[model samples]
Target: MTCSRMQSVVIPRHFDYRVLKCKVSSISVWNHLSVHRSLAMNVRRLEVLDERAAGSGMGTGDQTKEMVPGGISSTETDLEDTDDELGMHEKHEQYLLDALSKMSHLESFAWSCNHSPISIDLLWPMLLKCHTLREVEINDNLVFSPVTNDESEGDSPNVAVAHELRAVALKSNKHVYGSAKHPDFTRVKGMLNSCPNLESLNIAYTQPRSLPHAHLSADDLFLFGRWPNLTSLTLTNLRCSPSTGLDAASSFLFAHLNLEILHLDMSPGTATWYNKLVFPPNCLPRLRELKAHRDLVSSLLACPSDAPRPLEIIKGVRLTQATDLQQSADAFFFNLRRHGVNVKRVELTSWHEMEDIRRLIESTPKLTWLDLGKKGNGNHHDRLGGSGASSSGAAAKSSSSSSSSHFSVVNANEWAILLSAAPELTTFHGVKFFYEVSLQAQASIANAANLPLYANGSTGNSNSGTGPAPGATAHVNLNLMNLSMTDRSRIRKNDETASMLAWKCTKLRRVDHWEDGGGKVVVIIRDCGDGKEKDKVAPRWEIRRVKQ
Candidate 1:
């Protein structure tokens, strides 16, 4: 049976041994038992979870015995009990090894022991035996030792033995309130060296913990270069040593031509203390997307020229300082245009000015998606032209006036000018449109439709309609295809915008509006008519609102 099929088959109690063995092709045996022997041997993918409860069990049986519930125990009695517990622990480890040895065709293995730290020495031998293994995950404060006996040995045994391994995840299972104990860096490096064709590696905290030493060192960054085929790498809370310069770090990362996606989180501290990354030209040739801290992005944008490879997407944490943010924003777009980078998607925490938005629109003509909002609630307060106070004043003025108002800081005229610059724009978030602008857009559409038709029945001269004026090009193709906004003004719940869209914005298909009371309304437009007989009957427009 396939792995997915095997997962869904629930075994009922009271089945015969033959029947049970036949149907039970895969099992996750938490503990070593005689009843699971037959089932365990047939299992191809196994996940051995830690049996330790939150505050309960100690690591080994001996350690468990040392922590007696009673106040104080005699040393002689405790020593005797410890020896007895140690013998039982040795037996238990042997039993586990013996059981794992039966699974000759095991493909995947995962072990998590947060409360009870498992010794890597006990698990390595059994893992080495599984030549078919492709993925391995070990978490929960597991202690690791070098796979080889010689400390001076250049290569480890696991890398040489696990030929089929493609993915490895090593993490701590520390509770939110507890301190994190990271796995040995040397052991982790050895594992990477073993899997030359490794594609994905994730080493991060399983929960929030306050342990600075647990962070990966700057020198460890070079270990990633060993895996030439690595496609995805995720590292959280990485620490940079004073000796390691940002230039070296950037150069090492740029050397990885095969890397496509990277997620990085620097150690939490003052941004100024962090070394600025210096990316040279033609770096990250195959990198299509990057998600990192603002400091890292700022350093990248500081590069003298455009990136050697075309970056399509960038997502990063927002900078809080106003001056630092403005400089970063300016540097980012300026470098993008100067380098001729063809980035089409962006997600930023904030944009301070309308000019910045305008310049961004002009720089990336192919941009199709944009998100400008705070991290949690997606509320955007930054204005296009003014400071926070000025933006509030603009909003107040907009609310009182019917003919003009500011939506997310852009006035009606400014919105038209800004939007007109982006030819391929679509899927915008956190930008509302004033009612007056909607009406104006509708009027432009009506004017375009009223223009004289040619003798052959095709659209006339581009400059014929009042919408285009004397020499200006008509913007009939400018459609807000997918719009996401919050209606703070709370205009009347009429079909004014919908009607304008039907008449002018022919290509607009969806609009998501957030109402005042934390409710959402999604408007979808569908054409419900056959393609044939265009002249005989007008096309039908169906507008529907789904409330959330």
Candidate 2:
């Protein structure tokens, strides 16, 4: 029933019944008449790879017949005549169509063919007979043409209703390149309209390829509104006109209030579309998660004071290239804060400044998960933290004074201040901290002296000393579940300091220190309740590195 390397299969002539389920990469319908008959009669679910036609009965001219005693070759000419009678392409197409026609009771069909294009004219008529079909996936090259006068209209009552169809995916083959040939947008739209009750659609291309000149435009995408009950929609590399703004697109999307997730990778040229995108208040009431480019995020943030809706999650915001990263971030965060929007999760796919991080923590008080990690890039050392801040001139002076040093390290003192700001933080990833014994010593001294660390009520001494102050202890109450850091050697060298830092986090569980070249040394910390008086006493903590 399950196979990975099966090239061909044969069914005996006596097997005249149906196949309830059939999954195969290649089928030799031409070579085995009984197999073809069996498949045609009873395939409820059919999945095929359709890599190439099998058993075409064609042989290379290199096949030669042995000369008999009379110097005559008999079999070669006979084979050539047979091959000429049944052309490879024609035979293959006919056999596939015939097999499809036999499956009148089929409910689902999936074809993944990347080698060659299939004519929809040959497949559509067969599908029209499977009125019970519910799902279809065809990831291949499909040549589409308009219906002719002799053919029935797509929406005619004579056509199969396909009322049970709920999902369809018609992604293009990855091997097809250039914009020269592509699925007709009109035909694709017509096909989608046929699935009246479809709820989920994913037409995203997996690989890079230029779309045809007549690709879907902003207005064409508005056809999505036809799927009234649609819940999830994903379209990648969709081409749009430069003259068309996001207003139309947003209006169309707003009509789909039931959508829970919407992901779009608009054509690169449409990056400027964000400038015109708008979200009216109370729009997309059920949309909780969105994954798009920075433009969409910027557009949402830039909405009129009375027009924006509260979103639980907004991902793919870019803050790296902002003229004033801090100002831009503050504006974005403050806008959300002013509107009383309680976005619990935010993901920035670019570098963020230290002040921006501070503003983010300050604005999104209910945020539990924050990810500022760079994707697809191995270098983690260049992340902006507290190292290069001009405001931290005194701290920078003690370290490398060179302006060329790009690595920003958030020392223990800075971390205490930041972590203290965000109490609800549970998962923090992709931030590097500079760990050193001297910084910990300063923090210890400040705590012992009962000196206020910063104006923010943080307790950490900036003055470095030989050891911890007498009766000095570090304590913090937080709900942090995971913390990821870079620069391992520094953390390893200051184990005592790191331990002190870890001890303060009451709900701390795990720490990840990433190496420069792309490996992580994870340290797991478990809170073992204080023995004998577990309820009344604070829990004791244990820390150990997880072996690779």
Candidate 3:
């Protein structure tokens, strides 16, 4: 579209007869706006050239030269014509300003690479006219940070206009936090405190902890004095210590009320330090979720030697490792138990074969959901002896019972204790076995279940029509993860006896197996309540979803 008698002009491709007379009346507008097609393309090429020169901290003029070819103006222009219309209703000047103030739907604002200072100075006045601004999104690509005069100490033009925003996001040019020796994040921090309605923030991939004057520690959390309405908070690489003003943060939450979620992603080594500070009962009155890496959980519960603090069942937790699995698990469980907190669901990951599922299960009695899958290819084992033994072992010597309960890394032995002890369990999950559990051993386990006593390969008809036998309710639900196609095929091929024996336990509801080639094999659940016990395939059971 051509403008009136401008020296440089971007002409419209089609000139209709109706506007020809109007175009001729303003020849100066055409001359002033006369921009050649080649010049526009050359300016586009300069984008990359400018980027390279900025990387080298060299002359921006040289970069601009590389942007345009021959006959290009060397000086930057004072005026820029973006020709953008107003965003909100602009029927009248007052109506437009009023619409801006009342527009609550506005969530983000960005002004990068669109206009320069002279044009920006005009843009801010128009934006400030928009009173409805809630969020300001400033992309740092187009010199979003203002050029400050050392002597005047004046603020950025956009910063002055951003006072009404509730949330501010400053996506920097790079992940320069902590790495930069002298970080200049003026606009970054300025917008943070500017918005009175600001409650949540996310600083993507920056090492803010390493900043000299602006770094925030756990201690600073108390300075804000508990935001009662604040429901969520997140921090990455925020350096914090166990002794750092836990009472103050807790007091803030208690006083203001209604705080629910807290997320801290710190150094891997010091991640768990926050767990050590126990929230006094009802301190975080509305808290429902706490998320941290495994290392953090370990650090929080590391000092089991100290008085156990009651950490109620948070809605969710993501653990990161298995090195201190049992200790961490025990501390988490015991802490929650102190407040009689019953978790409705718990999802945890481990690298080793979990030996502490029993303690974890018994601690969270209200647990309706449990997932104990391994993250990497690691196996963990629990201590052996009385605690791991079968019910009958209690009649034997306590020492024998202990030994029976004590899990051996040996393949067949641990299954014996686990199958017997975990009878009332609703959901049992584990990684695919590293070694195949023999069919004979598996059959023996099935025979030892709630089923009637029978000799090998023999139907015990002698006890036909007998009343319910002792301990007849023994049913275990099992879920398996990380099973390769080869491993599953091996079990199907090598352990026909075990599969057949599994068929005998009518109460077995579901078996989720990660069959190697079969993908995830979910054996249809079966209801084995029929009087006539058949040796054929178990019938498919119906699954009913009940609301909690």
Best by TM-score: 2
Ranking by TM-score: 2, 1, 3
For model 3 the TM-score comes to 0.44
lDDT of 3 by residue, 420-488 (tens): 343333443342221232234335434544343221112212222431243332221111123233333
Alpha-carbon lDDT of model 2: 0.50
Model 1 agreement with the true structure over 237-296: per-residue lDDT tens digits: 556555553555666677666778777765664254344556667566677777777656
- What's the C-alpha lDDT at position 261 in model 3? 57
TM-score of 2: 0.60
* Worst 10 contiguous positions by lDDT, candidate 2: 477-486
**Shift of residue 484 alpha carbon in model 1, Å:** 25
How would you encode candidate 2's per-residue C-alpha lDDT over 407-509 as one tens digit per residue? 5545545554665566666555565443221334334333444534211112222222321244443332110011112212332333433444454543333
Off by over 4 Å in 2: 1-25, 28-47, 50-110, 120-135, 141-159, 177-184, 205-216, 242-247, 298-310, 324-330, 375-420, 432-523, 529-548
What's the candidate order when arranged by decreasing lDDT? 2, 1, 3
TM-score of each: 0.59, 0.60, 0.44
Candidates' C-alpha lDDT: 0.49, 0.50, 0.37
* Higher-lDDT candidate of 1 and 3: 1
RMSD of each: 13.7, 13.8, 17.7
Over 4 Å off in model 3, which ranges?
1-105, 108-152, 156-179, 182-189, 203-222, 241-248, 251-256, 269-272, 275-281, 293-330, 349-353, 373-548
